[model samples]
Target: MKQVILDRIRAALADRPGPVAVPREYRRDLGGTDIVELFAERAADYRATVTRVSTVDIAGAVAGALRDRGARRIVVPAGFPDAWLAGADVEPLRDDPPLSYAALDAADGVVSGCAVAIALTGTIILDAGPAQGRRALTLLPDYHLCVVRTDQIVGSVPEALSRLDPTRPQTWISGPSATSDIELNRVEGVHGPRTLDILIL
Candidate 1:
């Protein structure tokens, strides 16, 4: 009986796919090419707007983008970097939970920093860190501006996963929120921000 049980366990294990392997050197060597270009290409493919800008121009670009969206009130996470929105004409709303969904949904936009970006997938992962607030804040808003440092762009999923700590809460956003049903058509802003702008600073 014990032998049969062991054989069953071995069969189950053998049926599963082998663990994926990634080269260690690839992780260290990702910086050789122009990662910003790669990031932009991938983001565009996913239908998100990608902007490359110097630190000096980031604030103005962000403010202008918000204004273009006709957003007068911008929701900011508690730990968002101050410089990104300096002198912006919009009202800055902090990420307090008591901030109603109706009010947040009515706001012009939300701005925050990303934890890490995956180049291959054009994905941004956010841990509920200071600058990144609760998931709802990003989900409920119409427009979202995510600031990503150039150094945070990673070459692949394995490389990005290697850098993340599992203990922390995380949100992975790839393009604007979207879904399609029945006829194979697509719709945006189903569960998260309708417009996603990634500012690589």
Candidate 2:
């Protein structure tokens, strides 16, 4: 009976065409808009707090945000750019140490840089580079501060893919981690940070 039911469901979708494709002509005319605007709009749609600032103010801005949020100690991935956290006084929780569930859960926040950002999808891709640390560093913290440059924001997925080195490990984060069960109700932080602060410079 189970096999019969599964076969029926498969047959129902067999004839449906794949996702709609755009014509080449339409693709050619994909005029661009201001990247900062696109980034903020899409990030908001994904439920992330998006802040725009000049490169010079990055350190002070980051420190203020963390301090205002009452963060006592924060985690910094081993290779994260130094400028982002220069003014932040919180203890720097290095990613070199083994990451246990308890250690991550006890930390106040985490800071890191991204490999790229997809403006169309409001997604940030981490290549597990020095800035990204191990996957566990980002996953365990309650708050995450992600610094992405305007130059790194690509207009489309194809553009983003071209810059990413496929041979390396990567993590694509659209927003705070979330999930839902059979009821269709939504829940956040089931697996990762509950608050995501995106700094676009």
Candidate 3:
């Protein structure tokens, strides 16, 4: 019965005219503005703390950020760069199959690298890439430290989308998890990480 209904719907649509194509006239370039700087500014505007560091000092920066947040039990995804956490004074738990909800909740923080970042919207797209583990690893933790390379920063959303794979599991985060649902009161960490720190290299 389900297949018969679907076949009828498909046959009906097959006889209808196709939809019109919209013109693509939007600007793709960012007028020569520095995307990294724009991304930092937009990210900060979203209440996320952005820290710019040189590639050589990324380890130190990550360490310092984790130290300041007082993170003790850090969750590290599989294939995450070891050098980035070398200076951190904390026990790193590797997420091979991803940790349980209770374990993730108990963790102080999670660290990973994003697939691509959009400057215009100040958004980070995670396709569960190398350092980025399963979605649960990032969603359950209270704090998240994400590393974004300069080259991964794009001028517009279209540019970022072009760099991402549609078939992959993707998480698009504009800022820390938040919701203003109850009584119109704003709240953070309602569903995901409360604190988001981005290390731009």
Candidate 4:
């Protein structure tokens, strides 16, 4: 009886129409708004703080962000720009072999550069690139300080995906780690950073 049913299912599928082509045209316009500004606004909607600064002052901005959070020790991926943290007074812990779970938990924060950011969704993607460490680097820390260049901001999700490598491990973060589970009470830092501060350069 199972063999007979399987044969009928196959015959039914064979009679279905071919798939249709999806339309490629969509809203790709930025509506005369600057991509970086749009991204900052969308990020704020998700409760993530954004600070826009000049390229020359990025180091100062990074330092100020960490200082405000009182983060004494910060972890960074190997090959991270030394100059970015030069102004910060915190101890820099490089992730050479990647930190163990306990060590990351104890660290005050993690700072890294993102692969790409979406202005429409207010999402940041990390592909383990340059300053972006391994997956665990961003996940285990309580505070995440991500530096996003103005060039890295895109208008939409499709634009962001087009710039990323599909095979590489990617982490997409919209806002601080949070959940409305358990009686719908909102909780932060459940699975990732409770505070996400974006330094827009």
Candidate 5:
């Protein structure tokens, strides 16, 4: 009976029209606007703390940010710049032998670099690239401090997607991990870090 019904439906739709061409002229360029400034503004609108600094002040800025957040044990992902951690007044944990989830959860926060950042949507794209670690490293930690260079900021999602490697794992983070209950009660740190700090240099 099922096959008979399927045959009838197929026969009925056999005279359907051909594929239609849809226009996909989406905006890709950010125009003459400042992407870096726009990214900072949009990211801050999501409640993620945004700090702007120069390359020379990265070390000081990083240390200051960590100290401000009272981070004692920071998880330093593989390939993270050592100079950035110079002035940090905290114990850095390197995931050389692989750290357990419990340790990651207990850490003050995780610090790393991002592959690309979307200015329009204020999203941070992580592909486990240099200074970035496994997906779990950012997920388990309560706080995440991501350092993004100005050159890494892209105008739109398409632009950001073009810079990513599909084969490698990717984690897209916007602000902090949060969700609302049926009553509209907000909750943080449910799926990922409760707090997200962005350092733009």
Candidate 6:
């Protein structure tokens, strides 16, 4: 029944004017600016803890970030590397069996890799890729430790969008979830993790 109404709406709009072309007026001219530096600066402005680390020290960095947050039970999404969690003293909670919401909420944090990150907006995109698990894994936890490689950072939103698979479930996060709508008082963790730790490797 719901499908019938949607089909009727689509049929009504099918002939409603021609497809419109969107203007590309946004700035794309990043004249030799260091994107990584820009991304880190912008992400930090969003209150995310951004740490730049070499590939060799990624495991240590991840461990330290979790330790700093006192995250004892970290959600280990499927396909997340075991090597990355090697130095961390936390219990690795896998999503293979699909943990309950209570379990996810009780966990200290989550650590996963991103599909792409937009340097212009300081946004990270996840697509439930091998490193990224289901959307719930990242959302239910109080903290998130994201892994963003230098190569995955794009200069513009269009560039980032073009690189992603449209069929996949995508989550675009500019920072830890926040809002100032309720009584205009700024609040964090209302929608997502309160603390977002970014590991830029």
Q: Give all TM-scores, in the order shown.
A: 0.82, 0.81, 0.91, 0.90, 0.89, 0.88
Off by over 4 Å in 3: 1-16
- lDDT per model vs. reference: 0.84, 0.84, 0.91, 0.89, 0.90, 0.91
The best-first sequence of candidates by TM-score reads 3, 4, 5, 6, 1, 2
lDDT tens digits by residue: candidate 1, 52-126: 989899889888778777887888999887888885788889866568888788887888898889887889999
Please give, for residues 111-191, the per-residue lDDT of candidate 5 as tens digits.
Answer: 999999999989999998889988888888888899999999999998988888899999898888777874898776676
lDDT of 1: 0.84
What is the clash count of model 6?
A: 0
Q: Over the stretch 128-159, how does candidate 3's per-residue lDDT look in tens digits?
A: 98989888888888999999999989999889
Model 6 weakest lDDT span, ten residues long? 24-33
What is the overall TM-score of model 2 with all chains considered together? 0.81
TM-score between model 3 and native:
0.91
RMSD of candidates 1 onward, in order:
4.3, 5.5, 2.0, 2.8, 3.1, 3.0
Count of clashing pairs, candidate 4: 0
lDDT of 2 by residue, 1-201 (tens): 999999998899898887787665423112567766887789878899888889899999899889877886888888887778889888987866666778888999998889999887899999988688888888888899999888888777777888999998889999898888848888876768889989888
Candidate 4 Cα outliers beyond 4 Å, as residue runs: 1-10
Off by over 4 Å in 1: 1-31, 96-98
Residue pairs that clash (backbone atoms under 3 angstroms), model 3: none
What lDDT score goes with residue 178 in model 1? 81
Q: Give the Å shift of residue 78 in candidate 1.
A: 1.2
lDDT by residue (1-201, candidate 6, tens digit) is 999999998999986987799998887646688889999999998989999999789889999999999999999888888888888899989987899999999999999999999888999999999889999999998999999999999888878888999999999999888889999998866769999999899
